[model samples]
Target: MRLYSVIIPVYNRPDEVDELLESLTRQTYNHFEVLVVEDGSSKRCDGIVEKYTNKLRLTYFYKPNSGQGFSRNFGFEKAKGDFLVVFDSDCIIPDHYFETVEKYLDKHQLDAYGGPDRAHDSFTPTQKAISYSMTSVFTTGGIRGGKKRVGAFHPRSFNMGISKEVYQKTKGYKITRMGEDIEFSIRIIELGFKTGLIEDAYVYHKRRTSLSQFYKQLHFFGRARINISRFYPDEIKLVHMLPVVFTLGFFLMWVLPVVSPVLFFIAFTVFISFFGLIFFDAFAKEKSLQVAALSVGAAFTQLFAYGVGFLTEGWRKLVKG
Candidate 1:
């Protein structure tokens, strides 16, 4: 049995860490060690980690505030496993997660892998709606963990794992934040490391609790996409630009009325039809009217916020250039 070191970087989120730790205790496979790295958080999880001392092979480390990427690197430095796995603090590991990964690895020869995220049954309706928009084909084309990706599947850090050799060669993340995962994944591929998606090894990712928080998170994600493009200019694809087009078209809809009512009517119709599609798709997947309704708002918030962030950061990049 290959040992897996699970590294979780936490900030001021003790409650979330507690929940995540509790979930890890139920994993069916027992060949994993958990490392909780505290990144200069005031509300520490030391007390919470104490609770799991007997339940899991767990270690807690406190370090000065470096962003999540570097905090993960700190964990990577101390990992004593054949493979190092990274998970966000705001995630719940399913009981069968490791068993599925071990089974898959026995057949495939991937040096690194990433898995999709789903909203847990216990998540709030808003959280589920946000998850739908994030993973929906109508929005992100299900690329985050979906089978239909734009290009090569770049394993994200949230549910990513790599062999100890990969870390020894690449030395983990380069930048501390702003799309660090994307940058690291690109480097991993560039270094000729094999990467793939482990579809069955998904995690229950409880993203932001509220729509406003979700918007902020997506907005930062949009900026991060542009940030990744800085490291790998060729990575910018049509799929990434779709949000910008949506945002620009949204503003054009209102401005078009001043120029020509026909143009505005056309844009308005297209926007409404697109959002209607999102609503129906969400309904089909969730089977809840309330969730479907909230999904529309979530989708809009996602696209608009991401678009604005993309444009905002792109302009800054251009100015600096």
Candidate 2:
């Protein structure tokens, strides 16, 4: 059995890290080691690491806060497994996490891969609604879920894996902040490494506990999309611009009523029908009428927050040039 090295870059979320560690301890695949890289987080994880030592081959290291890309690369240098996996601190591993990855790697001759994220059953209502907004096909689900994905498959850092050799050859994660994972995957592919999607191997991503936090998170994500576009123009597909366009369209439709109510009404009705489609789809997956009822807000938040970030960064870049 090939050993897996799980590299988790953590900040100050010790409680979330503790839960992730506990979930890792419960994973059926035992031939794995966990490396907890503390990225200058004031709340340390030494005690948490000690608690899980008996159950897992866990190691802890501290580094000054450079960024997540640097932290992940720092852990990659110390990993001892053939399969190197990275997870965000705010994620829970399913018991079959590694086993599923192993199954996919053993059968498929892929160089790197990523899995999707889902909200846990115990997550808060806001989390559930936000999750629906992200994964719903009508929302970002089309992109983040890896369906009709642009170009080759890119695994997100939340549940991504690459061979140790590939990490060394392609150079481990160098991009930081929001879209680093996708940027890393682009680099991996550019260096001729094949990437695939591990459909069964997913992480329970907590994302943000509230809409306010979620907005803050995605706002940066939107900016990161533009940051990435500057480096890799081909990766910036038309789909990435949809959020910005949607945001502009939404505001324009409202403002246009002053000019002509008919035009505004036409756009409003069209958007409402599209929103209803998203709600029903999210409702089926979430099985919560409350989530279904409120998913529109979540979707709007996801798109608009991201749009603001994207547009902000685009303007910044334009000014710089």
Candidate 3:
């Protein structure tokens, strides 16, 4: 069994880190170590790491405030495992997460790999709704989900892994914020590093509890698309344009009805039916009217937020050029 180093860069979230640590201690795969790198956070999480000392093979390091990319590289420098795994502080992995990853990696000898994320059963209705909007194939055509991934297998850092040899060759994460993970993945591929997807090794990503927070998070995500485009101009695909198109269509959907009732009626009915399908699916699974209702708003917010962010960043680059 190859050893794994689970590196997590944390800042200002003691409680969430504690929960994540506990989940790690419960993993069924025992050949892994956890490293928590403090990114110059005012609220130190060292005390929380101490509590898990008895149960987990954990290491804690503190460095001056740098971006996640730098912090992850810091951890990798000290990592003793053959595989380096990166995760956000707010994620919960199942007991079989490493087992699932090892099994997949053994079958497919990729230099790096990434898993998917979903809302846990214990997650709040808001989180679940947000997850639905983020991952639903029928909603966004599986841009974020691993099961039916579209386009290239761009390994996300939140649930990503790399062999020790690859890390040494590529020098680990170089970019700092926003789209660092994506930029790193692109570089990995460019360097001839093999990458694959571990669809079953999913994690519970408690990304944001409120719609406002979710909007801000995705807004940056949308901007990342433009960031990545600078590196790989032709990699940007039609699917990347969906959010912008949706944003434009969203406004037109409201205006078309007023201008021409016949066209408006036809468009509105089609839009509502498609929207209703997602809502009903959430309602049926969650058995909560609140989840159903919030799903609609969440879906809209996801599209609109990403759309605006993409356009905003693209416009910024255009102006700078």
- What are the per-residue Cα lDDT tens digits for candidate 3 across 1-321? 889999999988889899999999888888999999999999999999999999999999999989999899999999999999999999998989999888887788999988888889899989989987877776577766446767668898889999999899999877788789988988888899888888898999998999999999889988988888887787678887888988888789889866999988888887788789988988886788988889988988988898999999999989995
Alpha carbon lDDT of residue 229, candidate 1?
A: 86
**TM-score for each predicted model, relative to the true structure:** 0.99, 0.97, 0.95
Q: Which lDDT tens digits does candidate 1 get at residues 1-321?
A: 999999999999999999999999999998999999999999999999999999999999999998999999999999999999999999999999999999999999999999999989999899999989988888896678898887778998889999999999999999999999999999999999999999999999988888999889989989998898888899888888899999999987888988999988888999999989989989999999999999999999999999999999999999997
Where does candidate 3 clash, by residue pair? none
The candidate with the higher TM-score, 1 or 3, is: 1
Best candidate, lDDT: 1
**Per-residue lDDT of 295 in model 3:** 90
Per-model CA lDDT versus the true structure: 0.93, 0.87, 0.88
**Model 3 lDDT at residue 140:** 73
Candidate 2's displacement at residue 102, Å, is 0.9
Model 3 reaches what TM-score against the true structure? 0.95
- What is the lDDT, from 0 to 100, of the residue 54 in candidate 2? 88
Error in Å for residue 263 of model 3: 2.8
Q: Number of clashes in model 2?
A: 0
